[model samples]
Target: MILIALLALPALGALLAFLPGRTGRLAATCVAALTFGLSLRLYSTGPGFWYEFDRAWVPALKLRFHLGVDGISWPLIVLTTLLTLLCCLYSLWKTPDNRLIGLLLALQVGLLGVFVALDLVLFFVAFEVVLLPMYAIIAGWGGPKRRHAARKFVLYTLFGSMLLLIGVVLVVNQTGTADLAKPAGTATLAAFVFLALGFAVKAPLWPLHSWLPDAHSEAPTVGSVLLAGVLLKLGTYGLIRVAIPVAPTGAHKAAPVLAGLAVGAILIGGLICLAQTELKRLIAYSSVGHMGFVLLGIATMTATGLQAALIGNLAHGLITGLLFFLVGALKDRTHTGELAELGGLRESSPQLAGLLGFAALASLGLPGLAGFWGEAFAVIAAAQRGWWVAAALAAVGGAIAAAYLLRLLRKVTHGPSTLKLTGPAGYELAAWAPLVVGTVAVGLAPLLVTGVTGPAVDALVEAFTK
Candidate 1:
């Protein structure tokens, strides 16, 4: 029932949002809040599947409506609900459109469903469920080039989806069952290749990442928040939950190439950010780099590497989510996101400047921050695999991250007041405060995440090794 409510509440809310007037908006917000509260009931102490619901869905195909939650997926589930709730809250003031709210709730259902799905067919259905709603959000409510950006997002992901569909069909044909709980049973390397390539596009790994910057730049504030915060996680999560486990030999064979491309994304993404003129574009590019680290961790195929990747996923979601929110606020106030035109933010809005600085520093993997552990451990995991060169270059990517993020701060926060701006509004603060508190809390005690993920990651590593 808890699992069902986690999806059903938002689904019902999405339907409610289509109704007229403030009543729809209020109901949606309340639904979001309730979903978050319901998500809390998912918590448990063990390193096993905490809650599961399974039923026959397609007898002919051997597909099931299977859902399960474990340490590995629980945090992401909570994060998805929390961010959706916050996005809904922000919409009350910023967007105020019933349709947009409906879209967000619909997106939440997809994201949560993706995390809990235990059958490959079920997972694919949830995975694809995320597409159109997000496309609509970006196209309907985004900036000047919303149409173009939305089109690109859909095209790229749809291409990935084609590959993913092929992979899913191949897996089911070979294994004779879609149950992820069972061994993949003689699935071939080609199946894994299709899956990896498909997920890579969504992960926007390096060469595949071009769609993201435009989408983020054009998406409205709440859209950007969810895009950075949780939508991207679907790819990385799919990699861990689906691709690697189902095709361990393929993953092992592909690790070197995967690691190489991930390093490229890290360095190349950082370099691009350094040259970016627009704030949102810079942040969007930064995701390519940040997710690079997570992919690197996964590529290592070590228990430590996998754990690092999980934490990296959560950290990026929190820190980058906050960055987008701040950037959106700046654009809303100054009527510009161009770095050159936006100066002396500190002079006009010291509080906002300070929060921006904090988010920037945290994003750059400052020691004692949430971002540090995953990056640091990823490097250590690479070294553990004796990939000294990869580790060294990845460290260089970290340095580049620091350089670009600090540059962003100097350009926006330190200059003499370019335009007078007010501090974040009450609702804006309400939306942002939890993220701020979460960043600090997670940074201070990574165990809040690591403790839960450790056993599950260890189990996953054991499976692939066998």
Candidate 2:
């Protein structure tokens, strides 16, 4: 029931967000804050699921309204709620637009649903629910090219959704159950391939990732934050939770192919980032490289590798979300994200420049920062898994990341003052402080995340190896 409340509160807020005008925004903010409090309470309970809900939803088809959380999903649940609160805070500082707040709350509901859902049918439905609100966010609130980007996003995701539905139907039909615990091994090769392909679209792996840069470039700040933050995790999470565990043999067979694509993304994305002149687009490209490391981690199929993947997911969320927020803040002042037109930010807005530097350092995987553990662990996991070539290539990715990020710093934060940008606003600090703290905290103590995800990873690895 508490789990239901955790999922329902934001949805209810989305409905209540229609209250008059400004009241709607206030209502949404309060609801998000309450949800954040609930998430913290959940975290305090510590490292496992507390609530259980299972009852028949579609009796004829053997579906159930099942929902729960485990250590595997706990961090993501908290992260989702926290990001929603921050988005709301940022919205409150801006004009309290009714539609924006409403959409945000609705999106929060969809994200929470993904983390808690235990039935395949329910997961698919929850997954589809997220698509519309995000489409609206990008299309309605985005930049001049938003419509095209939004359409591209919709088309790509919709196609993936179709494949996902096919995979789900196949799994349920074959196993006669929608429960995630049941082995989806009957038609393992076909089912796993379909599921992995579907998710890879959302994961935006290598060749399938063309839509991401456009979407990020066009989306508004909060849209990009949640998109890069939690939404991207959905696909990778599915691979971990559903695709691999259910079809271990198939996953093993596909590992080499996945590893190849992961390496491609890392190298290609890094190279593209080097040539990019637009700030948001470069950040968007960097995600490809970052997610590449995550993919490499998963492809390794070892306990250490899985742990690295989970940590990388969480780290990417924090680091990229911060980067988007900082870039958005600068864009708000300068009206452009073009690198050539922006320089000497430290001269006029030292605080913003400093934050940007911090974000860049974390993004480049600077040791003693949040980003370090994931990439470092990824390389270590690859080496331990005996893919020496992958280990070498991944190391190269790290060097490229450093190169591109340092270039960004020298071009935008140092040098002669080019644009007179204002420092960050109060709302910006309020939103940024948590991400900053998370970055440093995770950097200093990787165990905060590893501790929670370890048991789950061990169990999965045990199951897979069997």
lDDT of 2: 0.88
Top-lDDT structure, candidate number: 1
lDDT of residue 32 for candidate 2: 92
TM-score of every model? 0.99, 0.98
What TM-score does structure 1 among the candidates reach?
0.99
Candidate 1 C-alpha lDDT tens digits along 84-155: 999999999888999999999999999999999999988999999999999999999999999999999999
TM-score of 2: 0.98
**Model 2 root mean square deviation, Cα atoms:** 1.4
The segments of candidate 1 whose C-alpha lies over 4 angstroms from its true place after superposition are none
Q: Report the C-alpha lDDT of model 2 over 87-132, residue by residue, as the tens digit.
A: 8889877747778888998999999998889898899898889999
The global Cα lDDT (0 to 1) of model 1 is 0.91
Question: Please, what is the whole-model Cα lDDT of each candidate in the order they appear?
Answer: 0.91, 0.88
